[model samples]
Target: MVQLYNNGAYLLNGTEIIEDNSEANAKLATKLGANVISKDEAATGTIAYGILEKHNTSGNMDKLKIKFDKLTSHDITFVGIIQTARASGLEKFPVPYVLTNCHNSLCAVGGTINEDDHMFGLTSAKKYGGIYVPPHQAVIHQYAREMLAGGGKMILGSDSHTRYGALGTMAMGEGGPELVKQLLSKTYDINMPKVVGVYLTGKPQKGVGPQDVALAIIGEVFANGYVNNKVMEFVGDGVANLSADFRIGIDVMTTETTCLSSIWKTDDTIKEFYEIHGRKEEYKELNPAHITYYDGMIYVDLSKIKPMIAMPFHPSNTYTIEELNANLMDILADCEKKALVSLGGAVDFKLRDKVRNGKLYVEQGIIAGCAGGGFENICEASDILNGASIGSDEFTLSVYPASTPIYMELVKNGCVAKLMGAGAIVKTAFCGPCFGAGDTPSHNAFSIRHSTRNFPNREGSKLQNGQISSVALMDARSIAATAANKGYLTAATDIDVEFTNPKYFFDQTIYENRVFDSKGVADSSVEIKFGPNIKDWPEMPGLTDNLLIKVVSEIHDPVTTTDELIPSGETSSYRSNPIGLAEFTLSRKDPEYVGKAKAVQAAEMARRENKSLQEALPEIDVIINKIKDNYSDVNNINTGIGSVIFAVKPGDGSAREQAASCQRVLGGWANIANEYATKRYRSNLINWGMLPFIIAKEELPFQNGDYLFIPEIKKAVEEKQSEMKAYVVGNSLKEFTLKLGELTDDERTIILKGCLINFYKG
Candidate 1:
């Protein structure tokens, strides 16, 4: 029985309850002896509060804008941003920025391609007077956790799980456009988000993991969108029962819930976490008011959570290990059905092959990244696999701790030794497994992972390349159980074992020895490294009077993940090189996408070179001349030409800026979507100066190879208009209205400026 932290509650001392206040706590808490929120309060408290206050749009929002230091992205994304910002006239970086090189840590593909991105980052960090985190020292989240996170502060990353709320920071995972707003010194605007209390009452059972609890919560709230876009504030007795490491393990996975951010009621355990990390000064006891009122609540009894698994496609697709064992065929069939939506007929994908002798057998097990690589989680996995070999068969296990600190602690406690004795490969902190650059499996392999995502092609396989693999989300305990059985799927609950909570000793010496901390200094003498593959961003033209987009492809998948757009594995290293990486765009989903996009782009290039449209692409001339007959204003004028793809759902994983840039490189202009997957991907589009247009879910009027024209696009974007008329050039021009979602003031300018990079091109 998985007990959730039930939110529907009245504060009680065993049954004696107290009711909430009269008005919205955000408003009421500030009035009459409390701090009136005033919708627009700036920093009245600390640096963190100042950042939060600026974004609180209800009151005097403008006055709070001056506080932020700056915003940043990395090599995996900055090229597009810099290109766009430069198009808008970027002169110099406004604030202290950073460009890290952790994503393309695997340098196996395209030869020196990953290093090129790192060199580009080093140069950009120097040129822009920002920081640069070299590769392999830490994963993105772990590095951010150690260096960037501050109490009560706010940071928006292009990565979807840009949350670090446990450290008293109000971090958000948003698209690139939001970061552009910050880099341009513009405030982020949003309606105040509803805060939901996740009240945990009981302690967790043994052999369970943070991934299990997170999966359990996701299962409860995901399907119905109960906690979507809401802040989950964890509180209550169960919070006291869980150790700081355990709490953090669960906290890291909260981003998968699609929530804005999360916070836990800070206690001595939290304080100790800061002290152990050698930042005791940053510790502060954070708690809601005695009469706090949340919009809603989720109740979790930690003791009830058991070994869990989120089958393929989504984190929300969850069931227990026992449930999978009890009805293997039925769930396996369900997964196959889901594959139709996820894989989109790309390959024959299935989970049924894992079954043998009435039990499931997994080919691989991994414990890595922010969600799984904690000291406690690794120690537990080590204990479970104590003297058991993973076997000489296809079954294998690997473990990666979050940081050097955690890794050093594991070694100090002999957890590394134990894992090694048990045949588990312990590696450094790299996000490759989570994004598929490492530990690639054979075709039709099934892997259980404790990493962040298991999106299609995220298992280090390429469908177009005739390689395919799949993964299931699971805790180390259960993964170990399956490993111990030499590949038979087994639940931790099936075998009882004692879990000894061991104390961790932090050794910062590793980071102190290896990490180069600039401590916020500007060194002009440092020559930026510009590798051959890392070229300047293509000159993006400003938004024209109208947009002519050729629909190159249409994706009907419920969601189109970034991995599908610009796959994982080898391609991860080329994010910094725009044109080089663009060649791989839509390479996996539609192998012919690049050629098709390039064909349309050739027309745009010809136009740039002052060649006649009729002379370049005779087919485009016929379509445009037909449109000119209807709308006299339509002429072969100075306009940008690009290709567009309509996906039912897109922007699902990784905040790599390239997802949108590749489209821009291929002469793409706008994306017509039913809905976007995460905030980060949408922001990536807007920051790249692409029009994020949406049409009704059922009313997709345009098809591939069709031309769409939207007149007065820049004006329409400037003045917020949900509906804008777009023309499809076919037999006769069929006009359809597409909707542009809400955009903040800075966001509008970034689009007008062609991107944040151009905007900052001072």
Candidate 2:
């Protein structure tokens, strides 16, 4: 489906890929005579032009220096950001900031937690120069799509689906520490990246929706790592075939492909998107040259795209409706096997039970969030369900508009009436269902949704506690089709449905009349509000010359999702409170990571109290004495007891900061991973002052309980040293090397200061 050319290839006559390998020909002659086209000939030598630029951070990567524009976090995550910042020495909001409350709006879990986080957000907004959005006002991406995004602007957010390309913005979703860089006025440094061309050639088939296209592209690119860390620039003749809403749907889900960022060719469709959202001034024409060359190409024949579904466990496990129907039993049984690797025999998760009359039946269907809540998508779904009752069977249906304007448009167009007539409930713009706070199904329930993810716990199930549910991805049209069938999984293509949506009616009056916009200005002397449950950050220690850390948790899952780190649903309310929220860290992992990690942290506190190693713990002396007898060079070492963990892959869900900060509060010193699941998690680790280390998959030098001692660890970070030798024995001789990936300059100082909190202290 996609091909990348690593050699210096050129596009000749706009129809072929050729390497310039003729050595006998003159360099200039070979380059000029063939009507050659290269990336540099178009703009910036990248398929994505002004959307991205040089890193331009303040310091050297060798020194880990950085500087950033503004910082952003949401209520479900800000408490931890503030706590980490406070620990590292926060005074006032050093830069323009935004605190939005959307993830925890349901207030479903831990009574008083969600409301308390909201109060803390409002208070923090006042105390700092930041802006705060009250609960239910708007979903995070919708709010960003409106006021925060601008042409050629870069935004760093804590949510993994933080995309605003249709508005001409280049935004990245990372963990909280990355936001700390912006708050501390540090730059974001990254090596220049290569860009790929997503060349579209035809219009999508009738009854097919954006989610269908997104699922198609994700399936093709994800497993093979085709677009990982590369920018996807939409182009070609078919770019003009899709509407702005259609493009936005696909762009938002690109995060699932693990791409670094994305941009689309901007035209009237983009202008219409901004104009409908009341931000037309943010629009700019962004297009590649007629002869632009790409490092890679994805030739998408949109007409060939069809209704699709991503099986449980990942966004990439896809199959066409036709293929699925032909192999229902075999495909479903295969899904059960894959679930075993992830579910670990916790609960019997299956969809075959819903195969009524040999047609797969889903109990629920959802069309919501940044991916499916748009006016066009919902309006079309309403058209499909106009007078068809969904029936009061085991199957039910619900719809959520992405924002107030989208909701208002639906009401004005009679789409809401159409849906209501069909027995589908229409809700406001909230991300609750996407994260499992609302519309929870019974145990073993199978649902189809147009949301961003379907990770195991992402459906809001607590497998560790013996409760479980599952979700699958589908287009809005197909989800509606299944609902119209009274729960039997049905493909929309089987029915004839005509979409009736005119130009969208944008009602910006809601935001223009209510949203608080400071325009990047900071105001001091404001009295901040603090709820009783809101607690300050725990104390953190500065970097030591040599460090000893014990690995507390080891997970070998192919991909460790963020939902596993802190969880979503009811626990979301405590996101703004560090210590209170830490109580839930790894609650699903072993349900003992918090207390176990805290036990190790207490020893670090004792070490800072001017006590001898023997005085701190008798066991420590025994280990040290045994080490001294075997090796004579290492002695009298400053003992620092902090916990670290290892995972095959981690950080793959909502961009909540609490994931990394919770670990930091529990005394996490480092994370050793074979590879990080997403960019956000690693950034969170760096912001929390934790070392993001990498080691070979089979060469793990330390076990879960083994202590790893690294001499001159701080110096190694400062020196840009890739190979770090860590000893296993306290005083003995066994040692092996681990690696730390490339670090930006500001990153080193953040570690030395103990976290992003201290990075801003001075």
Candidate 3:
């Protein structure tokens, strides 16, 4: 259903695609009557380039320094972002900021911790001239879509699925430090990213929803890294075929493809979306120029797409439901094998046991979060289950509308009644299901979800405790179909049901009555509320002349998600407190990571206090003596001690800064990986003042518990050296090289100062 172009291509008059070959220039010239633009000029003709150009303030296209039009964060992230900004001398919000309490809406964990965060958000909005959406009102992205998204505008959010391209807004989801930068009136610095054209044609089939199309695209591109760190600009005649919610369902899931951001060519469909939301003036016509070029193109034929599923452990492990059922045992066996790698044998994960009578059975189904909670997806799901019952079985179904307004409309249009009548429990607006906070299944149970990710432990199973469950991603229609069957996995196509597509009506009164809008007015006399659990960040030391890093953990997983780096769900309650949250760092993956890192941190603490490092950490004497063999000047005063972790490719999922900051606060100084999975993760490491060390993908020079010494590490970073030498403090000090990727000058300063908070303190 998806075809990837191997090379650059040209779009003529937005109607045709001509591959960049020998005849490309001639074809373009023929179409434009002897007028053909250069590749560089045509590159500027994309919708992505235009939106970026409008926001870029660096005056140089090669390097972008962007100041976004707005900023947003959810409860799990806003507290920390505001705390960081407050520490960095934030007087007032430089741009419009919205704090939505959806991630931690369920105040069931850690007592009053979640509600205290809500109060903090409300007070911070009043004190700093921002906006605050109360819990159960709306999830972050849905609220932004209904209010904040504007055509030809740029928005930055703290959640990874922060895409609004279908609304003509170029929004990026980065770690909280980036939002803090905006709060401090600093610019977001990055190199100009490549733009890829996602040219869609043909309409989707009756049973195929946007999730099917999204999974199809993700399955094709995620493994090969075709659109990594690049913008996916959707452009084609098929754009006119989908409704606003259909396009949104596909756009929000672009985060799964590892793309930087996405933008769509807007038409009357998108304009109507704005008008429905009561922001008609924000709608602006956006389209690529007549002659536009893309570095690559992904051609998607929606009509050919089938009802799809991404098997347990990842969103990229995709197959059609028909294909899966025909070869149930084989696919289940393969998924079990993959689970061994993902779970590390912590629990006995078996999917074959879920098969009954040659058909796969799932225990739970969820249609929630930004991807599935849209009105159209839920309406179609309600239609598919108009008069059917979910039955009293192991299978349970729950639906959560993305926003209160959607819930109101669903109630108004009787979709809620139909869903409730069929035994589906409808909840308020919350992102818990998407990130492991809700709907946890029993051990060995299988779940079918319409959420964004299906990663390990992302379904709320604690593998370290010998408990595990798995989730398979499907569309809302398929999930509802499965629920209607009570337990048996079924595709919407197998059940012949007429969909009563209903019109949506937006209601703004709910938000107006419940939400706290500062109206861009700050009250200097207002006191910022502080919860007892909230804690300030611990002091961090700047980079020393030399470094000694102990490799505490070694992971060979092809890719390590942020969830592995620092888990979500229950741990989200500790997010506002830095040191308290660090205790859970790598708790699920390594279990011993925190203890090992703390031992290394103790040596650094001794060094900082001018105490005997040998007495504090008994084993440090031998390693320091061996390091002294090469450089006699290396001493406790000139060298720093810390820990590191080596993974094949780390930081794949989530834009949460804690993935890197948790490591930082626990005495981690560097990360050794073959490569990083996403730009946002690398940025998180940099913002946290951790060295993003890149080792070649060959056999390692050191193993876990090996102390590696890097002399003059600070000097190398200051000199902008691409590569550095490191020695394993063993019998003979085995040597190896580590590479540092591109870093801006400001980034170098942040490293030198220890972190963004320190950089701004100066």
Runs off by more than 4 Å, candidate 1 = 1-51, 54-101, 119-133, 175-186
Candidate 3 at 719: error in angstroms?
Answer: 0.9
Among all candidates shown, the one with the greatest lDDT: 3
Off by over 4 Å in 3: none
Give the root-mean-square deviation of each candidate in angstroms.
Answer: 4.2, 3.3, 0.8
Off by over 4 Å in 2: 1-43, 47-49, 54-72, 82-96, 290-293, 519-523, 611-619, 630-637, 730-733
Residue-wise C-alpha lDDT for candidate 3, range 586-657, written one tens digit per residue: 988999999999999999999999999988899999988888788889987999999999999999989999
TM-score of each model, paired residue for residue: 0.90, 0.92, 0.99
The best candidate in terms of TM-score: 3
Clashing pairs in 3: none
Task: Supply every candidate's count of residue pairs whose N, Cα or C atoms clash at under 3 angstroms.
Answer: 45, 24, 0
lDDT of each: 0.73, 0.75, 0.93
Worst 10 residues of 3 by lDDT: 25-34
Compose the digit string of candidate 1's lDDT tens values, residues 444-529. Answer: 99999998888888888888866779889998788877777787888777765666667988777777785554555556666657
